[model samples]
Target chain A: MSQFFFFLTAIIAVAGAIGVVTLRNPFYSVLSLVCHLFALAGLFLLLQAEFVAFAQVVVYAGAVMVLYVFVVGYVGGDDETVHPWDGPAQKGIAFVFAGMLFLELCLAILGSGLKALDTRGAGFVPGFGSPGDIGELLLTKFLFAFEAASVLLLVAAVGAVVLARRRGGIHDEEQRLSFTEFMRPIGTGTTAEGVGTRDAGINLPAPAAPAAPRSDRETLPTGGERP
Target chain B: MNWFVVVSAMIFCIGGAGVITRRSPLVTLLCLELMLNAGNLALIAFSRMWGNEEGQIFAIIVMVVAACEVTVGLGVIVAMYRRRLPIDVDDMRELHG
Candidate 1:
């Protein structure tokens, strides 16, 4: 059963990855990426790394892929046209490099003689490496790095906001607002009847007469009106 | 079947080729991600064969880092797209010296 799962997960992962690369549409690329991530998480689970697997799903499949989708949506455009092949010279160079790397990797794998790592020992059991174990190790042995990662995430969040707020940016507001100011309630001025009445009063005078005629004129006036 | 390994390897090679040959930045990014995932498959296979936990750990780490990379990379791509409407790698010559 485990072997079946291993094969299943591997197939899913590889297929999804292929889809991600080969699909021309960015939306499909992101969708395949999510599929790949989830499959990888399943593979991790089969290997008894439950915590890591869940984190893979949460962080990669959940959060990061969403970020990719958001950026793709914001930069809405068709995929750029891709030339099928490179120039002969570039292709030759790439082929040579790829061949060399392939040879090197094959040689290394053959010569290393290291057997596949056996996990039939400590930390190999299902649910053995629980979230609590991870949390403990994160806070104890890897405390500094853990905190640093948090700081890094905070920095990334702020940086993303800043990057998303450049002049002529899609989300740039007319006024440059600080982070706190941006996050504050957008319309806190008034929510009561007074504000509603005030807004109506402000808009009333302009639409008091034949607003329909005005709009029609603005859109497409008759020949008489045009003259 | 060992054919699974062969299939995975072939997919990886194709993905690598796409990454190297594609001029579209988004396609390249997608191809790069595909290659990374191919690595994940091999790692998982090796872990299962050797019965070791290390390969799984490495695969998990790779996935995490890949996620981070894709996020930042897409963010950069979006920024570039805003500056230049198209997402072609050829037109992105702002850094060329």
Candidate 2:
């Protein structure tokens, strides 16, 4: 019974990892990551690290992934699958190096006396992995680091806000569109789109009105928006 | 538990390959999360072996750091995209000069 769950999560984790790297769509990649995290959390549960598993789901799969989905939308890939392979040569070298590392890890683990102890990995850690226990440790031993992490989050939040703020961007073209006496501002392309628009939030700079000369919008100096 | 450790190692390697070869920054970040989770898994397993919560504490700290990292990284990527810079990692050679 225990073995069944162990294999299930392990396989799912491995499959999700493969999906994350191999999937052509960024949205699907993020979704795969969610599955991967959940499976790993289940593995954590199997090891009886209940708090870590909860934290894994809440912090990683929940908050971090939501941020990822939002960013994927905000940073809008072209309305096409992003081919993640840089080149066969680069990918080949990367895989070769990773394979070497995996082999090294296997040798290290096997030689580190784990094999002598049989396949059983976890030792008895009575009441060690609970939230209360971890919380006490955080307050006592890791207090300083915990405080530092809070500060880090605050700084990071501020930095992200400053970085992502609009500055002389799509607003200019939209301003022209709104101010033009002749054309009505028909909401279509970039605005009022939902997440199901497929990893959406990639508002094309293409004007909604087809008849308008698109040369001006394309000529916007910095953002050479893909046509 | 040893099997879990081995799985974690496999995951870490897969993440490493993804980070190295992926063209999109978002996917690269996703791979980074994978690597971090692998390390966390190993740490938790070790915590069980050691019969202590120290490793779990350490994993929590790592998670916090990962969150901060992803936040800053995505911000930079979004900023770059907003600027209409080429999103490809190969094209981001301005740092070398």
Candidate 3:
């Protein structure tokens, strides 16, 4: 039963992944990625890593995939612009590399002599590493790393916000702000005022109106007309 | 532990190749995800075979990280599309300099 589940999840995951890479539409690709992530989460469940599997589904398949979908949908509305092409040489190289990696994995698996490792007393069972156990371990042994990860997440959030924020346009007093100015302390006031200021030196020239045709009476006369 | 994992790994390898060889950025991202998931499958298989919890833990971490990567990657793709008007990687030469 467990073996069946593992196979099922693996197949689904692989299929989804293939879909993601082969699909031309960015939206579909993101959807396929979600499917792959979900299947992987299920595979983790088969391995008796219930907590990990749940996290995989929730963090990756759920929240992360949705975020991707949202971004794709928001930005990629026109499909006429997307072009796909893989040169034969690039494809050949990729295949060769992938083949080599596959062979390496096979060799490692075969050479490990995994049969010698006894599984009888390994003390692991389905769901043994429950969320509670994971939480305990995370807070105890991996506390520092966990804290660091949180800080990293916070930094990422701030970075994303800064990247997405639109600065002053051409009319603003400062026109362009340096990275250091953007990151300066909020209360500094000097950099804050410059944030939205436009550059006066770079004023855009007014657009010229279309020329009007001259009246027929004002047209230059030909020799025949003068005669 | 059995024929299932071996077969799944093969599928994963195929998916990975497809992703790397594909010209579309979208496809490449998908293939990368597939490869990562395939690794998750192997980890799970080993965990079951060895009766150890570590494999499962690693699999979970991979999934989470994959999710984070995909989100950020997609955001980048969207931003790229807005600036370039097309998603063709071949024509995207802004960063070449």
Candidate 4:
């Protein structure tokens, strides 16, 4: 049963990782990451690292993925705007290099053998990876590191908020405004003829007012017009 | 189990491949998280085998650190996106003088 569970999660994780790499839509890629992290949590359970598994799901899958989803949404779906031929050769080189690196690591692992590292003491006790044991260690032997981690997290949170909330100086504001205008949907009640034009930086005159839809008059009764 | 090492290696490789070939910064970030999780799996496996609390503790610490990295990294990416900058790794050469 345990082996079955492990295989299940391991396959899910590997497939999700592949999806994260190959999916063209950034939204789908983020979803795949969420799937990958959830499976990782299951793997943690299989290893009996209960606390770490839960933390993996809560932090990486939950919080981190939410942030990623937001960023992907904000950036739009098609952000990889490089032309097809621009860097195909470099991408190919990268794939070959990565494959070679993987082969090296695999060979090293095989050469070293698959046995666990020898230790001075016996192997871990049952429930050693449980939350209670972890909490005890956090408050005792590892208290200093725990507190330091908390401080680091606090600083990170503050830094992210500060960096994101920064209202840049006037020039930045102007640039940002133009970018927003550029990103606005073309047909959102804007009458400007040049708004949807392909030309860069050429603002043509606004088109005439759109004719009122005859369907509106036809759908409403003679005296049932909206006030 | 030996299978743990094998699976971890496979995951590490998949993540490495993703990081190597993916163009978008967001995809690269996702691949990085995959790599980090692969490391966590190996750490936990060793921790389980050793019967020690240290490995699990380190894994938790890694989780905290990964969280911090994602927060700051995504913020920077979003900031760059707002500036109309392409979020491609090759295009992000502003750091190069």
Candidate 5:
């Protein structure tokens, strides 16, 4: 049963990884990655690293994948099969390099007598790899690293916000009226022209907007409800 | 455990290939995440092999790092999209200089 389960997840992981690379749509690629991560989490479970497996699902598959999905949505799925930089020769070279690298890695792994490593090096301890055990280690042996990771995450959060800040500055209060208009088609959401032409920078001559002072808050739909 | 090592190596190679061949910055980032996860898989497998907590700790640390990387990469992608910049990795020659 264990062997069968491991094979199931291994196949899923491999297939999902392939899907991620071959799928032309960025959204589909992100979904494939999510599938891949979940399979990896299952593999972690099969390996008895229970805490790590849960963290893998929660952090990698859950939070990180959510971020990727949102980014894919925002960027639009403009995945060209070949780009100006990607010549046929370049593709061939990349595949060859990857093949060689994999060969080297396999040789190294196999040469190390991994079969011997199949035996547990450390004696079995009670409640090994449980979340409580991991948390205990985090607070005791790995405390410094634990705190350092917290600091690192905080810095990363601040840096991402700074990087994402608009060039016009955060205080710019002007809102794009078209942003409120989601009724129009967005051109399949896979073309650059889909979202590009609708951003806050371009305006469409007010579009029969009311001249009333309070019309700024009143979008096209709310005009019907106005007293 | 040996199978796990081989699996990870294969996934890592797939990810490396994707990173090299994919032109879209978002797909490249996705491939990078695949590589990172592959590394994490190997680490967890070894952690189990050694029957200790260190490998799992290292795996958790790798996860944190991966999250940080993805957050920053997505932020950069969004910023580029907002600036009307090309989202293709090949066209990002501004960074080469």
Candidate 6:
């Protein structure tokens, strides 16, 4: 039963990895990565690394992939025109090298045999790789590195905010407006439009009338205003 | 037992191929995540083999580091995109000497 599950997990993982490399749409690739991460988490469970398995799901599948999707959506150029096989020669060379590396690793592992593995006695320890065990070690033996990781996370958050921040980005007042109100600026009684007025948060006057005729240029910019 | 090692190696190799051949920075980043995951799996396998909790703790640390990496990486990607930078690695000539 375990072997069957392992094979299933392995197949799903490999297929997902292939999809990640071969898929044209990055959004689809990100989805494939989620699938791959879940399969990896299953493999983690098979290895009895319970805590790592759950973290794999929560962090990689949940947080990281969401971040990828967010970038794909916000940046909005995920569909690259490059064909997967556009550089068949390069890909072929890469595949050949990678395959050779895999073959070498296999030969090494097979030659080493089970004797190479340092199995500590033939007894299964209950709660192995459990959260409790990991937490205890993290606070005790690995305390310094654990604290360092927290600090690293804080730094990363601050860095991401700084890096993605727009110069002269949405001002404090502009930040408060909904998308419709900001773009259309048809209300709020400021009665002015363009450069400085828009920045100052003055309410621009509503157009003379909804049915009033406007030139192509005025309507072109807004793509025809939404309600 | 041995199969775990084999699977991990295969995954690592595939990830390496993706990183090398894929032109998109996002795809490269995804492949890097795969490589990190492959290492984590091998570490866990060794942990189980040796009956030690240390490898598991190390795996958690690696995951934290990978998270930090992705955060910064995606931020840079977004920043680059905002500047209308091409997503292809070869097209980025800002560092050209």
**Model 6 chain A — which ten-residue stretch has the worst lDDT?**
A208-217
Task: Report lDDT (CA) for all predictions.
Answer: 0.61, 0.82, 0.61, 0.76, 0.81, 0.81
TM-score of chain B taken alone, candidate 5: 0.95
Give the C-alpha miss distance for residue A169 in model 4, angstroms. Answer: 5.1
Per-residue lDDT tens digits for candidate 1, residues A1-227, read 97788678778877786687567787887898788778877866765567777877887778877777777787774775745554677756665765666566555555665533223323354434467655666677666666666666666666665555556642343232333233322332344333665333222212212324344234332321312
Real contacts recovered, all predictions? 0.25, 0.78, 0.43, 0.72, 0.80, 0.70
TM-score for each model = 0.65, 0.77, 0.69, 0.77, 0.79, 0.78
lDDT of 3 by residue, A1-227 (tens): 86578668767876776676556677777787778777777766655677877877777777766776676567653443423453477768887987787777676666777772333224564447698877776777666756766665666565555444444363253422343234333333443335534333322221111121122112322211322
On TM-score, the candidate that comes out on top is: 5
Model 3, B19-78: lDDT tens digits are: 666655655666676677677777767776766556655665566566555655665675
For model 3, the superposed segments whose C-alpha errors exceed 4 Å read: A77-86, A116-121, A125-127, A168-227, B2-12, B43-64, B93-97
Each prediction's number of clashing residue pairs: 9, 0, 7, 3, 0, 3
Superposed by TM-score, candidate 4 places the C-alpha of residue A205 at a distance from the truth, in angstroms, of 34
Write the residue-wise lDDT of candidate 5 on A158-195 in tens digits: 98998887767322323343443343223323344345
Query: What lDDT tens digits, residue by residue, belong to model 2 across residues A1-227?
Result: 88999999999999999999888788999999999999999999998889989999999999999999998887774433345554577878999999999999988886798542354554565776888888999999999999999999999999988887787656776666665423322343433533335224334344446346455345343333333
Number of the predicted model whose DockQ against the real structure is largest: 5
DockQ values of all predictions: 0.28, 0.58, 0.43, 0.52, 0.65, 0.58
- Real interface contacts reproduced by model 2, as a fraction: 0.78
Better of 4 and 5 by lDDT: 5
Model 2's interface RMSD: 1.9
Question: Which ranges in model 4 have alpha carbons more than 4 Å from their true place?
Answer: A84-88, A117-124, A166-227
What is the DockQ (computed on Cα atoms) for candidate 2?
Answer: 0.58
TM-score of chain A of each: 0.63, 0.67, 0.68, 0.68, 0.71, 0.68
Model 2 residue runs over 4 Å out of place are A79-87, A114-126, A168-227
TM-score of 5: 0.79
Q: After superposition, how far is residue A122 of candidate 2 from its true place, in Å?
A: 6.1
